[model samples]
Target: MKVKRSLIAEIKNMILQSREQAIRAVDNTRVLMYWNIGKRIFEEEQAGKERADYGSFLIRSLSEALQPEFGSGFSVRQLERYRQFFRTFPIASALRTQFSWTHYKLLLSIDNEAKREYYILEAVKSNWTARQLERQINSQLYERLLLSNDKESVLAVARGEKVPSNATEIIKDPTVLEFLGLKQKPAYYERDLEAELISHLNDFLLELGHGFSFVARQRRIHLDGDEFFVDLVCYNRLLQSFVLFEIKTHKLTHQDLGQLQMYVNYYDRFEKQEFENPTIGVLLCADKNDAVVKISLPENNRSIVASKYQLYLPTEDQLLKELKSELDKLDDIN
Candidate 1:
């Protein structure tokens, strides 16, 4: 006799879930074991602080003994990593079960405690994969936020203690678009860039910052018998607002800002619900003049923003230069 299909489906699902849970259990145990090892090693190292190379000697001796029995997972390199992990996060209770050793490996690389904490919060909150977390770290997401916001605000936002009031609080000024796979120094039209962004919508949304969801591409509107098309539309749930994006493959002009302002106004006036906040307009431009952008918008403007888009990830030298410039600007403001 044939069994009921639903019964078989249920059994299959149960088997899959059990397997997943078992895997998780083993991985969690491994993480705890490593933490214990690290804690012990750290205690020993601290006790021998007077010996200049005691820490190195301890790790090398431990690896030589452990690797032959338990495989290369306990190699010298990995032992050092485990020790560093314990040093980075001393509280065992604070370790998240959802994170694998790979996640800790990435987090261990971050030197700043606050920045590491921010990444940890975001990773757990977003349920980011190891690769996604690595990409965000490589993109300098934390440093970018520090450029615009105070450390307290950024941490508060990450920890759910405060709501973001400024668009710059969530939106990165110079958004990285290296995942779009567009060639650098190559001329591309707005439509071409739009197509690529849509093709890599996940990456685009990731770079777009938090709480954004895709709404439409080429959103159409009619105003007093005139037709207008917005390049892209998104909704930010955190802000409870519609986000209209206008793409420009050239340097931003006052006229471009004016066009984006009109789109934002239309959305606010017609599309946005009474409970929702005003629409936000952003220009994804290849280049922008900060002075022109400031003067083009009203002094109290919060709805319209201009953000430059980079085709490639900023090199270390480039990031240093950009960060230095932001610091100089802050000094001038003070």
Candidate 2:
């Protein structure tokens, strides 16, 4: 009797499935092999009494010996990294299946246990790549969280027990723009800033905090036969809305608020989907007029916000002062 066509297809699928299983098994084994290598290297370094110097010497010798035999993947620095990897994450089972060695390498740079755990949890939860994880770390995601939330809330986010409650949880005040490579001078064109932001788009998005994805730059909008351009447009995945931005080098003005409000309204009416949250307009200016900003929009306004940008990260004292100010505001009811 001849085999049915379906049986042939089934047999082919079985072969493919076995091949896939073998590939996965090999990959897992390789990961385990590296883990063991790191463990052994760490132990040997400990045995030598001077752990750091011993580890450094061990890696150098191993690289010199292995590089000739094994062409690549045996650099002294990489060997040290593997050793540090084991030291940083001692629990083998805790390693995420989705993360590569590169992710671990970036994570090791974080010295604080809570901060490191936060990045690991978020990276695994959000499925962030190595590059994304690095960007967030560099942008001081942990510091921002610490500034805005209590210890318990920060821990909850790190342990993946709770998501950020609102935009404010994930967002940071005083966005940093040092990566744009712009001079901290008096005169700069809107296009110049736009061009630099585009050039350093990744860093900008990272500094913007979680969930922002670039949508458009210099987005042109027509209003009652008058043409205007919004400096930058981005969509926040977490908020599920468009974030309209207006860039200004000088102090934020009432006119800037009006223009941003118009852009937000246009997006809410025309561009945004019905399911999306209301468009959020952010005025990024060098200086902010708090009184002017407060009165420019309605008291019930939820769609517009004004944020000041800084060329550099603030000092610890300055950050502490800002954090205290924000916390104090929560107490002012009258």
Candidate 3:
């Protein structure tokens, strides 16, 4: 007799759970084994302190002996990494079971203690795969946040000690769109950019930062006899507000700022619930004049932001230049 669909699903779920648990158990065991090896090697090295430093010699000999007997993974470089891993995380109790040896290895390469800790905390909270962790590090997500936020606030958010209260806390300027594979030099229409963003919505959302969820594209609003469409509508659960995005293929103007302000007001008047905060409007433009933006918005404005978007990742030189420029602007204000 054929099994009932519900019963079949239950069996399959049980099998899947068992497989996942088995994989996790194996990974944890492997991590512990490597840690133990590292500890043993470190202890042995300490015992021979009177002799000239022979750490490299010791690891090379160990690799040759272990590889011939056991397997291919036991190379001198990997052994050195394992040794460094133990040194980095000396206390066994501090090792996270959620992280595999690969995760720790990648993290060990990071020289900054605060940044490493932040990545670990975020990786655990986000349940990121090893690949995701690597990608975030490569993208300099932490450094990008540092652009707009104080170091203390950035570290606090990473540690999950403080929740982000405003849109500025989460939004990134010069948002990277290299994933969309659009040419940098070609002149593109706003609709083309919007379409590409929608097509690669997942990457776009990841680039958009935390707490954003897609709501609508070309969201329509009617007023009297006129109709208007917002480029994109998203909600930020953390901020508890509607976030309206208006894409501009050219430099931002006073008129663009006014249009976004109108959208924010519309959402505040019509869409926002009593418990929800005010709507936020973001103008994602190719370029922006800070003077024009400051003059167009209200003195106490917290609801609208204009940020540039980039078709490619900025080079190290470009990032350094921009950071210096920002610092200079701060000095001028002070």
- The candidate that achieves the highest lDDT relative to the unseen native structure: 1
Q: Write the per-residue lDDT of candidate 1 for residues 296-327, one digit (tens) a residue.
A: 99999999888888987777677678889988
**Tens digits of per-residue lDDT for model 3, 244-275:** 99999999999999999988999999999999
Error of 3 at 248 (Å): 1.8
Model 1 residue 208 lDDT score: 78
Between 1 and 2, whose lDDT is larger?
1
Q: How far is each candidate from the true structure, as Cα RMSD in Å? A: 1.8, 7.3, 2.1
C-alpha lDDT values of all predictions: 0.89, 0.78, 0.86
> What ranges in model 1 sit over 4 Å off?
1-12
What are the models' TM-scores? 0.94, 0.67, 0.91
Candidate 3, backbone clash total: 0
lDDT measured at residue 15 in model 1 versus the true structure, 0 to 100: 100
TM-score of 2: 0.67
Q: In angstroms, how far off is 314's CA in candidate 3?
A: 3.1
